[model samples]
Target: MRLHRSLLTAAAVSGLLLVTACGSADPAGDGTSGGLNPPPLKAPTALGSPEGQVNLIAWAGYVEDGSNDPKVDWVSGFEKQTGCQVNAKTAATSDEMVALMKTGAYDAVSASGDASLRLIASGDAAPVNTALVPHYADVFAGLKNQEWNSVKGVAYGIPHGRGANLLMYDTAKVTPAPDSWSAVFDGASAHSGKVTAYDSPIYIADAALYLSATKPELGIKNPYALDKKQFDASVALLKAQNEHVGEYWSDYLKEISAFKSGDSAIGTSWQVIANLAKAEGAKVEAVLPKEGATGWSDTWMVSAKAKHPTCAYKWLDWIVSPKANAQVAEYFGEAPANARSCAETAAKDHCATFHASDEEYWKKVRFWTTPIEQCLDGRTDVRCVPYASWVQAWNEIKG
Candidate 1:
């Protein structure tokens, strides 16, 4: 049975200042970069007594206490097992998560790739000694010590889950199944005023990804790593797309409502959003598209200023444990980080549907990474545009 509704949000915050630097080594060497050198901070060597409570800032549906739906509770079990009461604040966007982490109020955050590096660079997030997290050994090797979650080989957090941004279309509204992002870019006029795109600065990367294939000369190796010309071309494409857009959505629920009501015929979406839409009687389907897609690989990070480090560490270990990981992955509609979670899911085929263990399939999907002046794709001749610029361009694209 489907566990519950899939509720997810995009990550992209505007107006936050990013450190400007260049020519840093790309850690993952997968066309993504964590360029800024982080300040010195160490993980606790050993666990102390539970502090009785842990505060967390997380994306919607990541830290459920069953209050949203009586059957969908994971936080309760964690609280009961560790004697650490769970206090969660759901952030609507990654930008809100970064701002919340800065306050030093929350003990941990379920952060997306776009926000992870920023937290590390500012010293707001602390390194995680993998030895303290026994479950870390069971996590997918592909998710460990990667560009977004690590700095100079030191891990800053635990990988939570991942999913791609997909091209979702109304089966009856659009003609001929689209296998490419062009359906939403070049051919968007066919559905004029019915096309919906994700509303965030990160959406710019979607356009850049399309340009990589359509305009080969742009040399867009990584969507997040774009120099002035590449960045401008991407911005131009989105500005044009805006004319046909019915609405730009950050809230997944709004996108579902739009598709169900036939207000939106095509645009970007997630696997969970498409699943929830179909369940609600919307004739919709989501695809990775021939050009591939931009996505998120979220990490559960501890705050550098955590007041309850011991409990915070316990929460991290508990969340990624097989049972809890499976529940969150199923409910959130993403691949579980724990390799063993596949067998633990309520739906026997949940892991296969989400490609939880398919490493090859993940290669086509580019997980979200923060844009920095230092090119993530390792081009030393020019500086790539930073996220701050993308935030400005997004406003222009929408207006």
Candidate 2:
């Protein structure tokens, strides 16, 4: 669920982990503050022959090889095209993804914002040479070189896809059609033990995001950046919601099952989950509440110690190619990274349904990122709570 700070500390002491900036001083003498300092690793200057195989760590549904369904396969095409056979492991959480990347056994990972920074800081991931990824130029300008995927203006990964976390309810049970997140916050008790929430520390940002809109007096400009008073307010709200929570969910199938069984009449969800639940005869409806929502953007990053560096580069290019990007985005229920993918999706109105290029729509969706003591919102005086503290607080609330 949450990353254990002690495990990360042990890894850091062993030189297996080195987060760029968790209030730690910069090692490069750049005098920079609050930015990751990636390990000294050279970006590949030129492309080479494929290494015959590439191993990848990714979220579920990222690297489909037809094993899940007879028709839902993309890895086969990648393997056939690049001569780089694919071996993929699906990780369920950012913490698991980070720990796996540290082993130095995989070539790349489809990292979310929360894990991308840690990967770069720990030397688990290396800067990507855009020249090597021809399709990179077609990526949305907004996703490139953002806070999580780059350090000191150097790009670390290629943007893959993004999606907003929306509120889902059993259409038959939630009367009058709810339009705001308040249904799951202050008014969550209306549903009593049928309200659900995501099961990670990052979900704390969702609470903070709600407070940003509902309680502006707290001055929470960025949900991921909060001072002590703001952090305490969010934690207090979650602790109160704990009484009405039916279950906290991380696995998509678990939530889908709960909704089908009428266990979770109201909760958070992604577009794909709602589609699947509706297909399975569940009377469910999902929407981006008026208060906005928290979401995730994924980056495909190469391992610094990759055994198949050339293949890794090839995979990066292949995955983000217009056709492949469309496939994965449609399957995973997120906006495709390649702008051209909007036209390639089999579903005629796919991009519109996901608001693929609606920049204004994304303004309300606060993407997930690891919180640090330095305060992401740039406050200098008071020490802000970092992700580790969020994890500790989440444990306390659940307990």
Candidate 3:
């Protein structure tokens, strides 16, 4: 589920950015220079004294100031150590984060794949100077310089955390324990009107990934890179699953409550949500389906026009430091970006539970990314549908 609702104006905002970027031409037919490449926004020269206050836009629970749960706080510790008072605003979805970043009111944001590239393209996010973040070197190597967080070897943001979306079921309700995505796709009708799904366009990748295994002829190498035919097949599968959906969920607490109340018997879920559901006395189990699943690796990005650049850099370093990273990772239910945090987790086996460094396990989980007209799978013969199409298709599927 999306942590927040995407702005209804995402398509409009993205379209405007795309058109404006494409219109600028230094015109010697420089294929090497422009179009779709993120602007080379400069990184900070050096860290300076704390500005005393730093505002952040983040997903729910990412930057906790302790109001939710006193024991779950990391922000207060950072503030106390660095002298930068944290003023955080929780964003429900990537689109909402993008819109908020454009306002230039916040110093930093926790951006997902879908919004990170857009922020970089619109010049709303600056290229990060990794040197400024001392702990960045300790971040998991698998998370660094990937397609979503970096452009041509230039880092854009500091990796926050990563996790796969597993299929969660009420153990008492779903018999035989599902190992494949078919339990929620081709076989969703078995739990008709009791099945749920995440409420975001990015979820379309889950359908595409399922099809990559079930329908090899579709040539769906990368779930995010879909040609017209591949896109149609994925959308069709989602439409079919929609027929059995109890409800589409966005918030963690909502899905946890649904599972606890038995309103939803089977659906897509995060590792944290499943843990929370079980803690609330719900008889539930979660597993990564045999066909694998879609996941996300979030990044903590500084605003291009940050009012407190030095404080923003300090905040970035503070969050990824071992102690703080451990606290946030355990709380958020994701693998810590900092490898050093693994030993610091409250649960002795937390790292093992999430397969934090199991390269083989991660090889099967496709991380979320922003789809563009250019196919991410390196295909050029067929035009791939961009994220805008997925957003529009999601609206239709829900209807």
Candidate 4:
């Protein structure tokens, strides 16, 4: 579903109802232009413990019901452990999520990298009280204290799940699956005008990937960290691909539809497409290009004004539990944040299949973090152009 700006405004004002959310100057956000829009987001708060009822904002698929399988739902277990009634509002994209947070009604939200920092910065999210969440100790240390969720030296949230932007192609249509992102970006005759690209500002990262391989002097560490020269290089590359792309997808379901109908044969995708394609009998596979792919981890963050703080923490502890995390991993098509989730998965290859147990994969896969003026290369001197700039650049490149 395309998110209309009006619906987003409604969601924020309506108590986090099935509302769509949006952002404005916040009478508070950094006044800026270009790049990704600066979220009127609040910064993280190491506030006191959670309060009463647990209200959460998340994408629909993150929490599953027994409809798919009896053991899949993470909330029921949460409900049983703590009497706090769990209230969930599902958002379709990070933009929608950032919009909803303005209402200040939710206790926590599960945000992808693109939206996580916005929430942390907007002060909408309450920092993870690791003391309250014992299971936090089980999370991979590497996933914690990342630059996006941390400021100065404090951590804001816990990493939930992660996956890459790989090229999904049908083995039947293209022999020897395209290794480089070229099959999609280059748009060979067979794939010409039949390819798709992710329809978000962050997607420019893919273009940056091509630059990283084809242009080393630009030194683009994270595609989101585009200097003026590097940023312009990526924009030029994407403009070239616009001629061949059949669709620019914002939602996974929409991308699946385009690919399934054969309107698009080559495109960037997440692992879920491979699983969905196999189930739907579409001859498709996803290949992570050797040039490296951009990926992100979802984070579960609580709000300081939470009505049910204890329940919120209990939910956190439960969701990251080995069983709960694995259930989400199997269904979501990626590795879970909690370490023990790797063991209980029914699929033997589940762990390896999704890079669940691969520490090397974690290092190799450039995890997406919200880009800022400062470089993510662990340096204090250089900084990114900012997200608002990327957003404006995306429009120019797409048009």
Candidate 5:
């Protein structure tokens, strides 16, 4: 059994992550320049320097300072140095992000684990030449070698932010924290009406994770890529979890608001939310089950067809530098992709809180990878399932 959306994430910090203006906000009007297509931006020289004006898409809190006050805005610092203007949009989901990127106007994107591979595969992004980015050498090695964004062994982007999929609960209510997903799937009789999960196509992985734990016979290495038997088992588990969920959320702010307002009590979440709740004096704790957890890592990708390749690359380099990555991590609440960023964080233990620099800890952390037509590990006869299955299953479960 698995709680649906709200209980899964109660998370959007990774939503439309590294959300570069991949598509239009409205999704209605053709974001295209010519009448026929969503405008392919000329890679406007609108921006001037890596430190100056930049157009970026990111999640909430990634760019806020409690004051809509521009002075505190991180991008504002960039704008002051270069004559370039800054245009930023905050997206909450990856699909929304991919659509936005079609415009080709955005300078850079913080692509999530699930979407990064897709962007690279679809030819929407260009390979990152690490030589241009000084801090690239300081990133975690395991991250650099992931299966998703790396194709034929070349990296398509730079590492940015990261987090683990964990169970966040109201410790004030439950006696023993949910050690496994079963608590939520069983609808923990102790906490029924208050359960929540995430609402997104990517969340199918949550079910796959639980199934993998319970049914190892299926040989499912990646949740995003499930065989028919594995897929069926996972869906059955989600269907069972469906009964307990109170909401299927796609917004992080709403999840926090719900927890704060008493609409929710227990659910799955990331380290960021749990810590924030702690800061607010809420009775909450983030639990990493003995069974391990699912997690996400994001990358910085440039548009392959970009009109401003030079400017786009400059921005990517500057942003991934230790200092800039630290600022992004602190503001966003995810682990920094660049290892050196740890020393640059403004908050105490910011790196430690997110477990940014601990290579040993990171070594044990399993990350999400993109699912291709062939089995993830290249199983030939098995006819390994693909990510499309998860997308379909997610729709059915949400429905």
Candidate 6:
């Protein structure tokens, strides 16, 4: 299933969402920017007794407790080992995750890149003390200390897993094979009323990414960081593509059904969905387009207002432990963040199948990120579009 399950409704709460840079300002001062100076907060210096309970807001399939499938229970083991009774709520969207975190009811969240920066900037998520998480030592180097889950070199969360939004099409339907996103964009009219797209504001980045390669004159260095002109162009492209869209889907099952039923001949999809569709006798194939793709690397972040800090920390450590990481990653259909997990998966080639350790493969994937006024690409001249604008634009495009 896809990490985010429900369609995004409105954008975000007005002006509170703003993501800054990945690190401190450059000494040269060449139109670059720095990370946000979050409100005064500090991670716990030492572990305490378990709080006996930990609340979590996670993506579906992330906090499985054997209720869905008897064989897929990672939470049970953690609860037994740490004395932290697991209480998990599955979030449907990044916006919902952010809203849930703000209530201070949950101790932690499995946040995607688009929501991580917003949590960090809003002081809803706390800085993670890696020393408290023993499994942190085994996480892939490529997954650590990135712009989405960190600021100024301080870690904010534990990397959970990663996957790309791929192009999936019926092998029997799409001829000559496909290698680019144009199958859903510029060439979309050819598949009019058959092309599909993810139903969220973040999908706008996919359009921006396509334009980044097709129209270099726009100077779209980063899909998430778009100035006025660039943002308008991307919006325009989507508005045009919307005319041909068969349907916009947020639920993976719906997408899989669409492909199997031939309602959707071509569209953006996840590796998991394609696998399931084909396993069910759908003649489909999924691939990373040559133009690259918008993907997600989820992070397990603790709430700043966590009432069960010790248990939250324990849950963080347990989730990324080799065995648990492997279990969740396999179930969720993504590359595990823990390098040691490669040895734990039931499928001998699970790691290889998902490119778990392939840094070069991931280089072609632009993980989803929050769009803010300050350009994430470090352009300081003009204000870049924020996520709220994307949300508003998305509504109009769909209209």
TM-score, candidate 1, is 0.93
TM-score of each: 0.93, 0.89, 0.90, 0.83, 0.80, 0.95
lDDT of 5 by residue, 332-392 (tens): 6788877888888778688887777676665434566644444454344544445555566
* Candidate 4 TM-score to native: 0.83
Ranking by lDDT: 6, 1, 3, 2, 4, 5
lDDT of 2 by residue, 173-235 (tens): 898899998899999989999999988777888899999989999998778878899999999
Error of 4 at 182 (Å): 2.3
Over 4 Å off in model 5, which ranges?
A: 1-55, 61-67, 76-85, 186-190
Model 3 poorest 10 in a row by lDDT: 24-33
- lDDT against the true structure, per candidate, is 0.85, 0.81, 0.82, 0.67, 0.62, 0.86
- Give the candidate number with the greatest lDDT: 6
- Residue 83's C-alpha lDDT in candidate 3? 91
- Report the error of model 5 at residue 311, Å: 1.4
- Candidate 2 vs candidate 3, TM-score winner: 3
lDDT of 1 by residue, 138-192 (tens): 9998888778887667899999999889999999988798899999899989999
Tens-place lDDT per residue, model 3, 1-399, is 113333223344363243122322211212221225676579987888889999999888788877888788888888888899999998766777888899999999999877777787788999899999999999988888776777656788999989898999999999999999999999999999999999888888999999999999998888877999999999999999999999888777889899888899999998878877888899999998899888888999999999999889999998999999988888778888999999999998999988888867777788887777766665656667887888889889899
lDDT, residue 213, candidate 6: 98
| Model 6 collision count | 0
Which of the two, 1 or 6, has more TM-score? 6
Q: For model 6, how does the per-residue alpha-carbon lDDT over 263-323 read when each residue is reduced to its tens digit?
A: 9999999888888898888999999999999899999999999999999999999999999
User: Which scores better on lDDT, 4 or 6?
Assistant: 6
